[model samples]
Target chain A: MIRRKILFIGLLGSLFQIFLGCVPLTKTILSPGSPEDLTTCTNVFPVGPWESVHKIEAVITGGVSFSLLGVTRGDPNKRRLHSFLLTPEGFILFEGLLGEDGMTIQKAVSPFDSPAFAGGLMEDVKGLFLPPPGKPARWGRTADGTRVCLWEGPDGFETEFWEAKDQDRQILLRDDLGEVIKEVSLKGPFVNGLASYIELRASKPLPYKLKMTLLQISP
Target chain B: MEKTRMKRFLFFSIPIIISLLSAEAGSDQEWASLKEAAKNIRSVKSEFLQKRILPILTKPLRSEGRVFFQTPGSLRWEYLNPLRSVMLQKGDTIRLYHFSEGEWKPEMTQAVEVRRMVIAEISRWFQGRFDESKIFKNLYVPGPPVRILLTPKEGVDKFIRRIEIFPGTRPGVIERVEIEEPGGSRTSIEFRKTEINPNLPSEIFEKP
Candidate 1:
């Protein structure tokens, strides 16, 4: 009985260590590179203040889809953003401002007047337009020759940016469990390295996808 | 005590309700004339400017479009600038298209009902029976100003506060429509260069 108890405790100890181990993304294994490589990847995010208009096609969970006109103005350097979505006939569905004090929603119509909806929208916006939080712990190339900059948040979540040889880019966010919670693909005729088309797919408490095509952009 | 409160409320409210009814009844003559003018309209084609005002916008967002309407429920409404989209209706069938990548693509099926409602309202306006909306109480306001006010019924008021329609000097022509939301946001559409009974191609109503 004493030997059996020792074996059982040893098994539990090993399980605990495995649970606390660094979780690596199974698909992409990144090797160490340099700070210059990280800077090149960061340029994908816009710097300073800019305003943009986009035609957004959204497919919500259960396959319902709709189109909206999205107008956003943000100074990513200051972490301030104002955005609104309008129907084609000019009905405002949602309008919100994100400042130092966090998000404040000015107006939200039915189906959008929820706190969860507002938070999700802000998360997607920040994910696309702002660089990931914290310095990248790993800046390197993936096994497939894709340039990558990987940041690990204090909470153990991971953000990975990958730039393919064709100049297309992707941003993937993984939970502490190592499951991809969100993935964003950036492609199109880029101006100054800013992509004109963006596709964001979020899989979490609920799944939704937004396909945004740039209509206009200004400084 | 509650009974007395109810009694006092009715005592004050009954007279106000009567006066309001009388005021609407007085406008029946103007309503009949507007309807008469509408009967003369065979078709209408107009360029329109739409302005959306919201507290978030520094200025109203402006868009331009054109509308084509024919008798017996055939219509085409096309936005020409900022975003290019078209809504077409013929008989009971409705179609919506969006311009993307230099080509017109059909919009999703889920959003068809919402677009259908807009087309339906435009149809009612062209028929000069816009006041007959089931969701709103049409209170005709006879004016040197001349406009129709549509106030939403109980449940509908949660979405729409009111809608005001201004009739043009020409018979059966609508000068503008202003939609007010429960919030301070408003949308105004002003019609310009209106052409009445112009020869419009059938394809305009059939295709986007």
Candidate 2:
């Protein structure tokens, strides 16, 4: 009995050590290749002026609901935009424009506080979908298994690039502080089958989710 | 001199005569019945199709969806084709979703103008009462097709110019609704296959 107990404990120790080793090694494995490897890569970036419909399911702090709609393209830098919210039967609940400085939401049903609500929303959206300006300033690995490249701007505005191993595309982001102020992830064709999903998380939670799907690639 | 006098008399008398005739034709009972129909609708569910035309594009992009509304303050609008999206409103909270995003964002509901318009219209609808004092100056006119024209009052004119509701030949049913905006944008909804006051799941208004 004494010998069996000792053997069991030894086996458990070995297994624990193996798991620890795997976890640390996984971080390194996710690192991007040298600059030369990126140069030789054949992937092309997705350009915009795109539009697509999305079905959103939100579970925030345990509250859950669903919404549906389509979004049209505009530059976050320029901040001009158009989109529509529709019912399952094809009625337009709200329609509006998000422009450089503000936004307007019209024809909303109950619980929707149009113009004021939409203005803040468009700002949050711009942060998430637009890429960082200027240049990348820091390059390193995050403790949580991502290779990161960061760019810092005035007013605490910063952008990050996270790379995952065996993944063809990278995540481009603009953030304020630690919050994910704005971001776009590019998954390789393998994950979405030749299409990409762009996710924009609001700086503050809003009553809507905005997503873009790549329908076709244009040169 | 008699001919000249007669011409002057006819010009002034004709408008007054026409005005008197129209005033006599405007019966209060017809207006009351229309208001009753407008206010009595408790809930509504309908299918919709939206076609977007871009200035540079050759073909309009089309989408089909569904809309649901319940009294006091519950609404669910979802688009099931071309893409999936939904907006659900229950009480003071509204949630919108894009399935591709896989998340629902919370929004605030404090702004008054748009909210008030919606609430006022909905409450009136549930009660089956159409109050012109709140939104428009109501007019009932015989048309190429019979319709009720609601011309917006002062404050409401910024958004809507007029709305026309056409009752079905069968009575008590809304056959069509047309909303005209000040910007020349018009939306016309033709209600078909309507089911009124049907049993609807309470959870439909709850968060998903």
For model 1, residues B23-49, the per-residue Cα lDDT tens digits are 443257778888889988889999999
TM-score of 1: 0.68
- The models' CA-based lDDT, in order, is 0.75, 0.48
lDDT (Cα, tens digit) per residue for candidate 2, span B99-193:
54444444332222333334345334434455534545556655535565565444434544556666666445566666554444454555567
Model 2 residue runs over 4 Å out of place are A1-48, A51-70, A75-120, A135-150, A155-157, A163-219, B1-128, B131-133, B184-186, B195-208
lDDT string for model 2 (A1-219, tens) is: 999999999999999744532232223333444574333222222234444443333333334443434344544346455655443323345566677555777545433345555555455444434444544555555445455555576876555555556554444333343454444455545321223555544434443344555432212
lDDT of 2 at A38: 38
Model 2 Cα RMSD, Å? 12.8
Of candidate 2 chain B, the 10-residue stretch with the lowest lDDT total is B9-18
True contacts kept of each: 0.15, 0.17
Q: Score chain A of each prediction against the true chain A by TM-score and list the results.
A: 0.84, 0.52
Please tell me the TM-score of chain A for candidate 1. Answer: 0.84
DockQ of each: 0.11, 0.11
